[model samples]
Target chain A: MTKPRQWIERTIEVGLFLSALLSVLVTLGIVGVLLFETVGFFKTVPLLDFLTDTEWTPLFSEKHYGILPLFSGTFLTTSIAMAVALPVGLISAIYLSEYASRRVRTILKPILEILAAIPTVVYGYFALIFVTPLLQKVIPGLSGFNALSPGIVMGIMIVPIVSSLSEDAMHAVPAGLKEGGYALGSTRLQVATQVVLPAAFSGVVSSFILGISRAVGETMIVAIAAGLQPRLTLNPLVPIETVTAYIVQVSMGDTPTGTIEYQTIFAAGMSLFLLTFVLNIVSYLLRKRFREVYD
Target chain B: MTPDKTKALSADPTHAMEKDIAFKVEDLNVYYGEKQALKKIKVDIPTHSVTAIIGPSGCGKSTFLRCLNRMNELLPNFRIEGEIIFDGQNIYDKNVDVIDVRQRIGMVFQKPNPFPKSIYENVAYGLRIQGIKKRDLLDNIVEMSLKKAAIWDEVKDRLAHPALALSGGQQQRLCIARALAVEPEVLLLDEPTSAIDPIATGRIEELLRELVKSYTIVMVTHNMQQAARVSGSTAYFLLGELIEFDETSKIFTNPGDRRTEDYITGRFG
Candidate 1:
């Protein structure tokens, strides 16, 4: 009986360990595949031109494989999304966590989460049909398939993500800190902004990075609302294609499997992964660099 | 409860005041939801004097100390009954804002909570909250308060550094300086030196002794010797009741209540 029990324990332990190792193996496999294909893309299109060229018309007769267009697309959408999400999400989070009565918070939190749970495809249509019309009233010459619509909808999608993460962060701030704030005769807003907000800065930054990363990787909404024109421009009112949207466009079309066009998707994905990875590292390091240690 | 009685409770304008006291309490009781933490605690905290509340763990001395500044009321289910009269006004009156009460009466915790900010910012925080933004004004108060807390010389050069980098004693003194910067009428310290070393504790006690000349001090201490040394008046508490309150010498030398005597002599907690 003792022998069987010990053998069983060892078997279970090994199984758990191997299960944990599978994630690492899968990640490495993905990196390997991406590097193999990105090398293929760089062979046909020079690495410097791919990065620096003004145009990104890969499918057109006058071909230019500039990666800048996709990067800027990702940059604009992520910026607009963050501009929408960060303040709205953070303020709502502060209100929910700090000031809202228990009944109101209970009612509001689930409603915010449900907004997040709505399918991204539905949000795509909402952007094109509902949001673009609203924006067109204010700014003329706004394209029907523009970056602004998808960016705004994507921001709405990430709102719950930002608010919930930020709420959790603000909630984790020790009650002692807020009590100390009150002890100094600070008003509720002062305590929330001056003390609690600073205390939860790292968590709040982590939330923003997570929200922006989500916006970068978002596919369906951008593919539907933001047109397939991968033009390198900063004007949000113009139709533009993000790297993820471009990959979606090509994948849905008849691009031969073994061609350079096929490998370009992998190259795009590799850059996307690197973009998000760099964002997480940079924000976390920046937060830690200037933060005050409470514990 | 009526208007005329309320005026009389605050003391009539024609009446000549005798002892300068910080707080006058009546039938003060505090409860955490269902369970009572303090029962009928009635005491006078004299103005410009150090009053030490000495008790064992869970004896409600800390709870009583928190009641003065309405700090205990911050807990979700905390409920208070009766009145705490301060500056001839009931601090718990319906019209009285808890923020205003806390501003005039400040508190320091058992552990040094220095906001993880710069030494300069820690002292400036209270004044900043009051909306005085002139940098020179903040600088002067920060210097004066830090000097008053007796940690100015050690921290003057490192004012911009993170407050947590300071030693435990220095951090506690910094907290004191932060409290002092607000110019509170009364300062409540909840075991301010419990976590520090003997030398640091001595430094803090010395600072408190000097501080009582201007601000009234109410300190909760686990150490009976500390209570005997620092406080002008001492209140002995046991099981959520005020067992005795008198001059520090009387409580330590010849306490009136048996429970107070037993606690002082270390017969039982």
Candidate 2:
């Protein structure tokens, strides 16, 4: 009986080990696939040209592979999204954590989480149909499919992410710290801004980086609302195509699977992946350095 | 009973001698939702002295101490009644700005909770909150406060180092220095030495004698020896009631209440 039990335990251990190995395999496979296509694309378009290109018109009859246009679009939309998300999200978080009663927090937190659960495609339509038209009434030069609308909509979508994560960080600040601030005769505003905010800042920074990462990678909203013109301009009034939108545009069309146009996306994919990976690392590092060290 | 009559009746013998009272509690009742944490707590805490509140765990000692500066109002379900007269004004009055009340009454917790900043920044926090931007003024106050707390000698060289890098005892002292920098009229220390080692406890107890000259100190301590050694007047509590309050000497030598005697002698809690 003991021998059979020991055999079964060994079998379970090996099974558990394999399951753990599966996660590492998934990450390896993604890197492997990206590198395979990226290498092919770089071979046709010189690495320097791809890096330094100011225009991204590869699909045109006269092929030009300037990747800057795509990058600028990605940055522009991400910046707009961040501008919308950061203050709104952080203030909402502060309200929830510092000012809101427990009863209000209980009622409102899930509703905010529900905003996160809304499908990104629905957000895309909301941007295109509702937000763009609304903004056109105010800004005369606004394009039919400008970066501003999608960026703002995407910002709204990411608000819950920023607010919720930041709220967790602020909540993790020890009650003793808050009480200490109060004891010092610091007003509610003083305590919140000076003591509580600074104590939870590393966490807030992590949330911002993660929010930016989420914005950089978001696809459906930009594809639908932000127009398919990868123009290398900072003007929000002009139509723009984010890196994700360009990828979606090519993959949806008749660009042959193994062609240079098709493989350009893998390089773009690499850029997006590298961007988010760096952000996640920074967030992780900041949280570790500050959170564990303080009381 | 009338307020003056009640105050006269509850006045312990030391009250006649100690002319400057820091706080006077009268029928101070505090409730956490429906459950009563303190009931009819009435005592006179003297100014420029250390008044140690001693009680068993969950006996309303900390709650009573918190009520002096209206710190208990931060809790959602916390309901407070009766007056805590600080100096001449009622601290619980609606017109009183809680911010000013807190500025005058500083508290250090059982755990040392220093900001995740440099030791210099930690001591300078209270001053910064008050919008004192002059670097010279800040430096003078920080130096004076740190010197007063007696941690200046140990931390003088490494003032820019993160406060978290300090030893546990050092952190508590840093917290004390931070509280003292605000120049509060009264300092509330809730078991400030409980989390520190004996050597650190000795340093804090030694500092208290000097501190009480400028600031009125209200302390809640579980250690009976600590109460006897550091405090001028000691108030003993049992299940949310003020059982005995008198000169620390009398409480230890000849407790007026039987329960106080039994607890002091380690008969039972």
Candidate 3:
């Protein structure tokens, strides 16, 4: 009877360990799949042409396999998105953490988080129908489908990401710091700007980097609203194609399996993966290096 | 005779001796939302003297100190009904700027809360806020304030190092230097040495003794011995009520209330 009961307990422990192992396996499998296909893609297409060539036209008869134009478009849209998101998100975070009353914080925090919960596809539709037309009205030169509308819409989508994380960072700052400033005769604005903001800076920077990563990897909004033209232009008013948009475009087309056209999608996927990976590494390093944990 | 009787006898001489009042509180009552934190408190703080408020935790001693400079007004739920006059001006008056009041009546907190900036910046912050742009004046003021706080020798060489990097005692003194840089008429220290080690605490006590020669200082301390050593005048409090106010020597040696006696003797808080 004792041996049977011991066996039962050991079996349960083994089951828990196996489940934890399986979870790790699942993560490694996804990464392995992305890497395997990406490697297969580089084999078919010369690495230099895929990296350095200016044009990305897999659909045309004379297809040029460069990833630069897609990268530039992705870079441009993400820059615009960050430009819109960083200041508004950071200011709102400062207001919530430093100035807002309990009632205002309780009500406004949930409302800001609700923006993050809205689906990306819905943002795509809004960008396509509402934001695009709105931009056209203000700027006569804006194309019917341009990167500006989607980038701005993506900025709105990413705002909560920046605001929430930055708020958490600002909230972690000791209340004593602000009290110290007040004791020194600093006004509310001065304390918020000089003391609180500087203390929470590394966290704010990490949050902004994470927001940029989210903007770079966002697919549906750029696909629907930002037209699928891999033209390398800095102007947000023009139609452009990001790396994520190129993947969606390739996946939707009727290209035969194992063909160069199909393989080109993986190449773009690898670029997207690399960009976000670097950003995540930077976010981690900034948090670890600069964050001050008060006892 | 009881300590209370002796205190009553000794109090008259100090009251008769002093002619100037640094701050006067009249029937001050403070409330946080529905909770009354400070009962009717009326006391006169004498000029160029060290006044210590001694009480158990949460007994409105700190709250009363904050009231002198309207620092309690920063809390959202904090409301008060009373008059606090500093240097012949009603601090709670509608026309009076709280910022200006704070500038004239600087504060040092319980924990050493130096800003994340450099030590030089922390000491220079108060002067900078007043829009003093002359580099020479700022350099002179920083050196003088640090010297006054008794931390100049320790931190003078590392002025550009981050203020947060200082030892706990050094940081607290740095905070004091920051307050002094503003050249306030009064200095309110809310448990300024509570977070430091005993040796560091001794240094702060020594500094406080020196400071009262120039600044009217009101300190709230949990350490009974500390109150005895540093203050010229002492106010005993219990459960939001001011139990007794008298000279520091009399309060420790001869208190006028049973509660004050019990508190000082380590019988009950």
User: TM-scores of all models?
Assistant: 0.92, 0.95, 0.93
Q: Per-residue CA lDDT of candidate 1, range B1-269, in tens?
A: 58967776788655725447799989999999899999998888888889999988998988999889888766778999999999889999999998889989989988887775789998999998888999999999999999999999999999999888999999989988998899898999999999999999999999998998889999999998899889999998888999889989988898889888888899987
Give me the TM-scores for chain A across all models, comma-separated.
0.95, 0.96, 0.94
**In model 2, which runs have C-alpha deviations exceeding 4 angstroms?**
B1-18
The 10 consecutive residues of candidate 2 chain B with the worst lDDT sum are: B13-22
List model 3 lDDT by residue over B1-269, tens digit each.
58966876678776757546899889989999999999999989988899999999989999999898888888878999988888667899999998999999999999999988899899898888778889999999999999999999998888999988889999999999999999998999999889999999999999989988889999999998999889989998889999999999999888889889999999977
- Model 3 residue B177 lDDT score: 95
lDDT of 2: 0.91
Name the candidate that leads on TM-score.
Answer: 2
DockQ score, prediction 1: 0.61
What is the C-alpha lDDT profile of model 3 across A1-295, one tens digit per residue? 6999999999999999999999999978877877877788888778899878888888899988888999999998898888889988998998998889989999999999999899899999999999999888899999987889999999998999999999998888898998888888898888888888889888898999989999999999999998999997888999999999998988997988878788788778877888899999998999888777687
What digit string (tens of lDDT, one per residue) describes model 1 on residues A1-295? 6999999999999999999999999999999999999998888988899889978887777888888999888888888988899999999989988898778989999999998889999999999899999999998999998889899899999999999988988888877778778888888898899888887888888888899889999999999898888888889999999999999988999999868888889888999989888988987896787455555
Candidate 3 root-mean-square deviation in Å: 5.4
In angstroms, the error of model 1 at B170 is 0.9
Ordered by lDDT, highest first, the candidates read 2, 3, 1
lDDT per prediction?
Answer: 0.89, 0.91, 0.90
Best by lDDT: 2
Model 2 over residues A1-295: C-alpha lDDT tens digits? 6999999999999999999999999999999999999999989999899888788998998887888899899999999999999999999999999999999999998999898899999999999999999999999899899999999999999999999989998888888888888888777777778878888988899889989999999999999999999999999988999999999999899989899989988998998898889889988888777674453
